[model samples]
Target chain A: MKHYQAWCFDLDGTVYRGETAIPEAVRLIGQLRDSGSRIFFITNNSALTPQMQAEKLMRMGIRAAPEEIMTSSIATAGYLAGQYGRMDVTMIGEEGLREALEEAGHRIVTEGGEAVVVGIDRQISYDKLAAACLAVSAGAPFIATNGDLAFPDERGLVPGNGAFAGLIGSVTGVQPVVIGKPESHMIAEIARKQGLRKDGMILVGDNYETDIKAGLRFGIDTLHVDTGVTRKEALAGHSEQPTYSLRSLSEWEI
Target chain B: MKHYQAWCFDLDGTVYRGETAIPEAVRLIGQLRDSGSRIFFITNNSALTPQMQAEKLMRMGIRAAPEEIMTSSIATAGYLAGQYGRMDVTMIGEEGLREALEEAGHRIVTEGGEAVVVGIDRQISYDKLAAACLAVSAGAPFIATNGDLAFPDERGLVPGNGAFAGLIGSVTGVQPVVIGKPESHMIAEIARKQGLRKDGMILVGDNYETDIKAGLRFGIDTLHVDTGVTRKEALAGHSEQPTYSLRSLSEWEI
Candidate 1:
């Protein structure tokens, strides 16, 4: 199981529920760490920052250093910074967006910026939409973290970045180059960040469509665990064919 | 509830499941029909032909007439016919694609003649991909049905039409204007074919991101059921709320 130097895990359905911790998941992480495997949680959920994710992990009895978490928001900001340095960014988001950009070495500003970086702006207004469209049309590269149209939470669901991307994509005639899980950029970043080769990196998660298929997209070994949403019958019939299937992540032999 | 004269429902996750009758769903359709509401199903699943879908509906007790089902393949063929009469389309598809084009007056030949119509060529060969790419590069307008990157099945997940679009989108620098649900084109066609008016036409489906959201994209009311890839939690949090949330098609009140 530790044949790969690094192990990438997915959050939400993988490590924890929306807010609750998966005890077995925490144990598996501990096992991985004891085995000296570099652990990283590559999640597409862009709503939270890495610090928040690390804090969540700590709360769940899974010790994750701040560097151990790489979110779509961070990856997107990283990709943007790699493209252009210190560019003006018109943000339509929360603190995560601004912090990610700052961490990625880019200047974040309000209006008349060079680039429009839109995240899950829950308090989105028509005025903000109009402003974003204007920024995008004026040559601001509309950088979206992940293309998740909707995100699941305790409250139900919220329109994720993808819905906003569609609106801006329609207006700007430009689509965001997404930089999150399911895309090679995020996968590559995790691989590079942990100094682990992409070869033989096992991705463990419950969601077959996003987690398992994302592994396939990036060419990695996948072990799908039936956590929150997946059922045994559904996992049994998966044509996506994960390397291993487990009722729980703890079942895997370390 | 029957305020609109026409209603366009999507098949697959909308009306019935794979080879099974969503009986309550069928009953709802009957009620709508008895109430003088016209119904047509627009499906992007090009694996099955429109006639096949129509037959499946009848077998499932939905009793959809032959003219009531509209598949993306059929719509693609319709698109090609008006643009190029008896045009040679380099197909990356199955019998569904061929039948749709052939019935719509298109001559699917080798690599050259007029246009190259690419469909969900599951058994994608290098030769087929090359031909499709070459034809598109040679100035054929690329068209796709839906942007679904992966299709979840009983066996697992496989690349859907969105994969082909990604390939095409990667090349040619022009994204294919997808013409299926989520995109207003197919919705408009279904509405026109079913003799459904824009008003009072409610879309019932499981997937909020695609089905419910697609219905909304077309200016139609949506009824979200507890089904599809998107979970109840995800749908609940989304600010872009659907009109009605029913536990199942059975819970739908007239």
Candidate 2:
């Protein structure tokens, strides 16, 4: 066994976004694979299913098994279902939200929908907003995927999970229950399932607020890769700074 | 008869959180005092700032203003602000957001702390959270003054302006320009100076968001009555809300 035991890498910003892969990062993953290191890919984007994510990884030249990939969406589903016990969910989002709820045995309904599930729906319309507001106002427990205000795309930043949550909150006059990374339960489960303590574990990612801030609670070591969502200026004045800051993941050793 | 045609008001939820009457929301003042119509009192609190808002009729008893109160805070502050001058503003959150900006001044600064002469301070905080965050991160204009978030007694939900705007948002990011009723420029100047707007008017009182929402752009109307900080949930679903929401003052027409 290697002295450095396990390595967990964040996929979206660390490995790839859409089809683009970080030049230096590709080499690091390949080297790690060749070195026989146990790797788990984590992501905040919960839009797709794990199977799809795994496939995307392979296409990017980073070979990933389905089990190797973990997503905030997946964690969210498990958390909600485990806590509420299979509920009736009303979705104003995409497949990831629906898949998570359904997989948890929660019945999905709309227009007279009982429980509320809010997430990023780029295709969201005013009608969906109306339905969601109505459901939440009618006393359905509201759940949000994440609180990311904007998702920076190739073409500047656009509305993300937080914007959608804001709409629901504005209408129902209530904020939703968030179930993604940075929050404990999901990360705790990730640690437990991987048979590791949050401390001593290495969390590599791109974003600062969500990825890095979430790592703060676990006392885990974090390495931030630039050229992704987080800029160089954002890395200043922190009570908890990333243990290591790398231009890319190709510098990984052990 | 003058070229002035619009009336604006701001007071508690308008200018100062609870010191002076909202200057922008004093529309009925000009109508009853100076003789003008087409009244609009823009406010931030959609909950109850406008509807329950009334002019001071007597000591213990209050009187009616109108059903023309506008709440931009509830409208998300995006609507009216986009209409007039500079799109971006340094907001302290009054009359939604923009109406206050347009009514008081077109351009807003997130960095020039003292240049604008004044602005409201919501949710002020400690360390880099309040002053530094605004100056460093959001480039906010400046700190207006010590605005209270909650009021004395009432025992309900006592969230003061300092809690939401000052604490959370300042801690998170950005400082906004406040265009609400009681901001001295909007309220006091009405008495000192006149003939600048389409209408000449006067507004006063306690709350900040509502009293300031309907500043002089559309028509002058204001008066912020002391409703404590728990006034948010007071007017959640009111239809045909107030043109003037006040807590005291036996001078204005009821």
Candidate 3:
């Protein structure tokens, strides 16, 4: 791969598959870090905090700092802080989203908030959903961390944050502002935070629909790896092609 | 209304509105009962059992039997019984759904079920949704009691059974077989139970989307009253209008 100032990587399939690390990806990331290229781990997963994500990467033999991690939750937090300013928010998510919102100086209230933010919540309940609907209908801003309909786990693909968001949106007749992949919000926020332009940024991921589309939509170059959800053949249907399509991360050279 | 042997009425908007009985509806129902016309109360609400619905009607001064009540739960149970026979099923609903399934001789399993049934569940949880998604991804037949996206509550419109079902459907990439209004399944089942033809039945209600649409789709006559969701002006937008439009139930004569 040609040198880019910002090398944004997608987790799950791009850096690791489930609990195991992709050696080629880990090696490439290390090389990129050694060469002084700014690395950011971008993940749609809002279930884990940046610290947790960095720790996960570290366990896979890839040195990563919490500051270098850009989860959907973090992006959502940044987006809210930048766009809506400090606001009391009702949330439906896990520790990651809660921490990010609180860290960004937003109060997380149970009800009657200025905004309703939704992320992947394992302890999701009807009451939470009801509260969200009530808030949204009452004119509160509705925001979703990511729009990933499902995520693969040991039990196979389970309902993700987007599914719940969709449910709320359908019920309340209000569309949530999604701040994850396939939307330019995360990439734009990352670029804004780092003081870089789209020309110097390159997004690497296995999923063409989210990662590649995000990069393409953000006006940045994208590299597609076949180790995830989208295979080489599947890209044939899409009109827009990525900058590079590699069989593995090791196949690309700086 | 002209003499129709089978008088199917939608409960919420047609008969009563949030615990208070509509006086005209009560009077009309009483007259129908006195004239020996079979009265069937249909509801998209799967939260209550037929007994509960009947009791609620009885409290509203409208005598009703459990057998005369046709809830989405009952229709769902009948659909499953007729299609899949005795099979293990996963459920995301309340007491009504559980009772109907069990009474229909279907085993309700936590996981590894032959079907995944959804209904109006106030106590819905992530675990329930996750289990449903996993089972559906594993090729379980997905079924929803009704497709009412939202329903009016004390706090305004809240997420209904359809919203939850839509969430699971989005996650698992499976469409659920709805057994409520606008699909004609409940009406058809009711007609079958009464051994009556669609031509001989008339569905009366306030909502055009659910009640009138159900009758129209079932190839029966429909009576629209300006009592609920769809107003009279909104009916002008619909190409297929109800067989009768009344200002109130008192305006109709048997």
Candidate 4:
């Protein structure tokens, strides 16, 4: 397989499953780094900060700077910053989303903000959801990290940020701007930031619905791996196939 | 104007707006009660108990018995009790829902329930939402008190139980069976309890969407008042008009 200048990898299923790093993916990333290839970690998880993500990768023997991680939270903040110019944001999320907006020089207010940003909040309350609905109804711009309805947890698939966003949307009758995979906002932002062309960028991940779909939507080559969520057998039924499908990173010659 | 044996009135917007009673509605209800008309107050609100609703009506100088009050909570509990035969229920609601379920001899559990009932819960948290989603995904019957997306609050409109139910439904891909206005569930329960036929019942309210629609769907005559929500002018645009449209309850002579 030919190497690309920009290799965007999905963190959760492709590189690591829960706490353990996939050995084949780890070796491939290490080899890509040695060959001076630009590597970026893209994730839909908006609960942890980019630094936390980088630290987790480092523990798995992967060298990653905080800037090398492009979380949905970061992409959302960047989108809002570009459109609204560091406006006051009323957010319902955790440290990751909070830090991303703050890093973008945006103020977080309790009420009457210019925008309402939603992410996965384990501590989510009715009051927070009410406030978001009120703000959105009062003409505040609604922005969501991702549109994933559910995510795999210890107990099975649990409600995600998209579910909460859907609640607020149903209440206020306002659709939010989603800034994660399957939408291509994150990929577009990464390409714009790195001064790279879409043709020179390639996305590698396990999930065809989110990671591969994002790459396809962003006009880039996508490599679907059978390590997680979407099995290789599931791809046959889909009309639009990924650019390449591999069993594991070990199969791909870097 | 002729008076009916059964007078079903919508509490919010029709009888009272927020806390204060609409004087015209109050007087009409008083007159109807003096004439020995069967009065039943119907509300989409599942937060307060029937006794509490009766007390609220009494404060507005509108004489109402606890038996005359029928909330979405009561309908939901009744529906569950009849179908599942006092089965264990996992609920996300307040006192109204709790009391109704208990009164129906249904056991309320935190998890591993046969049904998941959702009502208006002001103290709603992520844990509660997660539990509800988990139960629903696990094949528990999903039932919601109402489908009202938002309700008027001190700070404008706030997200209602339907919004939260919508959130859970979006996550689990399971639509909840709504037991409130526009569904005819509550009205059917009222009809069955009073031993009254649909032809003898008359539903009076200001809202065309919930009040009139409920009556129309239940095969009952509906009286639409222009005191709140649906204005008198707005009724002309609707293809299916109410059985009787009046400026206020004061217009009807018994």
lDDT of each: 0.72, 0.53, 0.90, 0.91
How does residue A162 of candidate 4 score in lDDT? 91
* Best-to-worst lDDT order: 4, 3, 1, 2
Best-fitting candidate, scored by DockQ: 3
- Candidate 4 residue-wise lDDT, A76-178, digit = tens: 9999989989899999999999999999999999888889999999988888888888999999999999998888789877899999898888888899999
Per-residue lDDT tens digits for candidate 1, residues B1-254, read: 33656666766665777777777778888888887777778788776777777777777777887677778788777766656666777776777788988897778777663666666765655445555555676677777766776554453344566656655555444577676667766676666555666675777677877787778887888878775456667786888888887667787666
Task: Kindly report, for each predicted structure in the order presented, the TM-score of its chain A compared with the true chain A.
Answer: 0.90, 0.87, 0.97, 0.97
Model 2, residue A99: what's the lDDT? 75
Looking at candidate 2, what is the lDDT of residue B6? 41
Q: Model 3 over residues B1-254: C-alpha lDDT tens digits?
A: 46888999998878898888999999998898888888998988898999998998889787899999998998999999999898899999999999999999999998888999999888888888899999998898899999889988888888899999999889988999999998888888888888998777899989998889889988999999998778888899999999999888999887
CAPRI tier for the interface of model 3: high
TM-score, each model? 0.49, 0.55, 0.95, 0.96
What value of lDDT does candidate 2 attain over all alpha carbons?
Answer: 0.53
Encode model 2's per-residue lDDT on B125-243: one tens digit a residue.
22212233344243334332223343332322233343333332333344434433333333333333333443345343344343433332334554345444315345344442344
**A13-106, model 1: which lDDT tens digit per residue?**
7888876789889888888789878888887766678888788888877788878887877887878877787787887777777788887777
Clashing residue pairs, backbone N/CA/C < 3 A, model 3:
A1-A253
Candidate 3 per-residue lDDT, tens place, A42-71, comes to 988888998999998889888899989998
What i-RMS does every model get?
18.3, 11.7, 0.8, 0.9
Ranking by DockQ: 3, 4, 2, 1
Of the true interface contacts, the fraction found in model 3 is: 0.96
Provide the DockQ value for model 1. 0.02
